[model samples]
Target: MAAEAARQAFRGRFLHCLPEGGGGYRVEYLEDGVLVVEGARIAALAAAGAAELQGLDLASCIDLGGDLVVPGFVDTHVHAPQLDVMGSHGEQLLEWLERYTFPAEARFADEAFARVAMADFLDALLCQGTTSAMVYATSHHHATDALFAAAEARRLCLIAGKVLMDRNAPEALRDSAVGGIAESRELIERWHGRGRLAYAVTPRFSITSSPAQLAGAGQLLRDHPGVYLQTHLAENPQEVAAVRELFPEAAHYLDTYDAHGLCTERSVFAHCLHLEAAEIRRLAETGAAVAFCPSSNLFLGSGLFNWQAFAAAEVPVTIASDVGAGTDLSMLGTLVDAYKVCQLGGHALPPLEAFYAITLGNARALGLEARIGTLAPGSDADFLRLNPRDVPLLAGRVAACRDIAEEWFAYQILGDDRLVRETWVAGECRKRDGRLAVGN
Candidate 1:
């Protein structure tokens, strides 16, 4: 009886996504849902009045009545260290890196500062209802280690790696090609597959990493079978031109990385705003994914992403905050920018599709669809409870909504952190009533 009593459950209006034919998804909503959690995974998700709830301890279930429950957001491309630089005066991608990003990252050499910043960064993500993320730490190996430590302590399903840059960066932040790969290997040995954490071999992008470092990064991926590769690609026209000049022999920007064996099934490229048609086909062929960072792209004055073109090419596309460069950390807020970006390209993003991108779509891009993205049985119980009526204006607008789709669109356009009433991670309450429940 005691063991059975220990199981956790929640009753609410649940929403999630299910794959349909033709690589599209359909929304599934249970108006009066009962989500039963055992240990760290969901045991059952059914109607409140379903037979599955007959003998369960509903008396102690967390009743989130009148609120919307959905899977927590998964951010595919964000810089954990760039939290300090977010909302700074926006500059072009290259100048922004030199002006704001590099200087801020230089501070991470001190492990103490890195620990504190990483703690705050993770807490901020939870506050914004982000549960899982692929993060980039500074080149300081100890700082990267601190990020992994903080994430492990919180039991987050996080994927991160230290930046690898041997040239084209500030002197203090650069690491030798040999040294960078060795440190990444050590970090991988120490942290990969530990609890819910994974490692990504992150080369800061072709502009920053030399040929040797990029090749070494690819080698690390081969050596560590399940490890991931994350980096930027074709974000700005200037950056693209520079890559062309630097890699004269390569076919294109994507070819530079592909030549080094960096394009793989687990690789995730961010801000592919200027990818050629050939590059798009190659991304699909290699099973690589793209992180459509709309907020960052718009903020940096980068060209608009052709969302329709990517979809037509069958390339896996996921939404990301891309903070510092990206203006907001809330995936809902990010979707607002994404909607506008798509609109600029003559295709509006549907509300359900926007929600799916931040949740299951992002998860599938990271190869984590079976775990953190859904409320399906046996998946990790990482989810959010959102209150559309958190503010007076939002309440008024949401009240006029005709259906769940309209309400969701209203939330996406008008919502911020306040919409997130609670953020639960692996069945543990991390944020309650829009505040951090755990000590920082």
Candidate 2:
């Protein structure tokens, strides 16, 4: 038997979500308990039955008393330095970036600022039950290091990198093609696959990166085959027009990245609100996943994302809290906005579908399905124990619900950080009794 199992404990009441198509998920009940320790992966449900706790001095048992236990949320896109600038009023994407995002990012040159902002970002994620994130750091390389360092100490699965841009922004945030490529390659070699960490080759967007810079970023992607590639595509009308002027040779917005080899199976493109049919087909063909930032889209008055387009193209979509422009760090808020976006587009993002998108759907998009995103045996036991009674609205909604599915809907639509009773990352609880406490 594994050493962690030697001193196993009760897992508490967990409602594990199993994916079912058409906005539906099946909840698995683990009333018996679950166990973990010694840096081991999550165990099988039946493993709880094999070990007896009476004979061994073991790790402390945490009884959740039938709280919901689902996989920790995986956010595909967020700008770490812009955490404080989230609610800045902006009319559109391009103006928002110029007026707010650029100035905010330039501050990351201060390591102290980066450290404090990163601390808040990570703690905010933990409070909301988000243990993994594919984040964007500023043009400052040290900022990226600060983010990875914080995540490493917490044992969280985090993917992040320095933002590469040569044009269309502040001089302080710009990097030449050669310089950016060198820095990105070095970062990938140093951090990729180190612990639960992955490195992302991030270009702000086609509008911000020159051809030379995009080419270098594409080359970096080739060199670091397993590292993720993240960028923006078709977010706002003016942004799309800017891409047209910048890359006149490319057929469309997605083609710019496709030509540079940045569009690939593991690449994640955010805010595909304006993708045309051909662009959608190419995205599907390239096996790229869309990081739908609904709140940001709405906040900036960018076009609404058509989930039906992704569905028709048969491309998987993941939800993200694209913070800074996105008002909240809560995945639940993102889902609620997703529901609104879908409804405005004459469709529905049901509760099960929203839960799955935040969990399994997101993990699969990041190619991290095997490591997390489910309660199956051998996956990491990173998840949250949520008290539906924690929030007054949630309590009222749950009181009216008839089953776990309806109760989950209440949490998804009405819940926020307050609903998160405790968060467990790699089987170590990080938050308990409404206080921040690291697990041993």
Candidate 3:
């Protein structure tokens, strides 16, 4: 059934975030809370039994027994077309594309196949507690449209773009400079700012897109302001070398994009693992966001992202699954990997900060924090019901928790899709039992 944007009330142990004095968050943990949802927006949040709610009708209330409701995860970097090629092993960046990635994407040329694949990908994302994402579709315009149409029907907050690769790639996946730019422009006109959807100007990366095509993409961004830019950079040593070989006139790998005005506040650079001090500072200075795919990085044997350096540079960073290459879809799993990634370097990821990274921080990175990130009033009602008691080890861990902070800490480290009891979007419960909670 399609979820109606109707008013409802939820009583649970709720977690929400507000900006603290600095860039950190002030977490509000309501032990016994009541959150009122009127249509797609959060109307009010208060402790249960508050007299202010006494006058409201209580029959519409839904009680989540001892489960925790937190904002849904926002994945800033994902490949909607590469769902079936995730675990193909033993190849670096360029070779992986030739061996596994490109071949899988070639199949998107069949529009029917694209539809089925995108539907399952969206379903997987919801089951994994990802309500909002910035995705990359294939080079086929119709294939990308299929992904957008799927997201539109579900009212998902998604930002996606068709891959623009004019030079390198198999004959089936390549589009000419003029043809690719025209297709992108048409897509932007058709889909940009449509409902909860936005369009990104995607150039697969320097390796696939020629200088002419990259320049064309930059022109598209200028022609339509606020359209996002998504692409890869410095993800692998060989990939970086390829970019240097391809764009020898540029000072660095980032300079390849900078020369064409692709670097902007709205741009999302995925897996910036081997960035230099100058690149880090430039990313901060330009207000461009970084999509940190720790799980994908580890799985591909790419270098570790220096999180502290990015943080110290005051750059905006968001966590993502980068799936098909990424091991799994769970944000908790991503956080667990992020924690391990940092721990290996003798650093710590505080659980509160980690939670904030997946939710509010990610929303902020996409410039959509005002719309989908928090349970704050007037924000969209997208969240997940986490049952810490659902898993055996998690149940025991929760039983020993000394406080709410400890409870969250245990959940972040131990939780995954198995811990997600339900997923809600726009005041409607959508997923349970690793599938749709409500059916048409």
lDDT of the candidates, in the order given: 0.91, 0.82, 0.87
lDDT of 1 by residue, 1-440 (tens): 22443587888899998666666677899988888888778898988778244776666677887799999999999998898889898579999999999999999988899899999999999999999999999999999999999998888999999999999999999999999999999999999999999999999999889999999998998899899999999999999999999999999999999998999989999999998899999999999999999999989999899999989888999999999899999998899999999999999898988989999999988878889788989899898999977867798999899989998899889999999998888878889886788664
Where model 1 places Cα greater than 4 Å from the true spot, the runs are 1-5, 20-22, 52-54, 57-60
- Across 1-440, the per-residue lDDT of candidate 3 in tens digits comes to 33354767888889877765566678888988888888877898888868145775544568888899999889999998777887778877778889999999999889899888888889888998999999999999999999999988777899999999998799999999999999999999999999889999999999999999999999998999979999998999989888888888988999999889999999999999987788888899889999889889998889898888888899998999888788878888888888899888677988888888899999988888788879988888898889977788999999999988788889888887888988887777779767797542
Model 2: per-residue Cα lDDT over 236-255, one tens digit each:
88889889998898899999
Overall local distance difference test of candidate 3: 0.87
Worst 10 residues of 1 by lDDT: 1-10
Worst 10 residues of 2 by lDDT: 50-59
Q: If ranked by TM-score, best first, what sequence of candidates would result?
A: 1, 3, 2
- How does residue 288 of candidate 1 score in lDDT? 95
Best by lDDT: 1
Candidate closest to the true structure, highest TM-score: 1
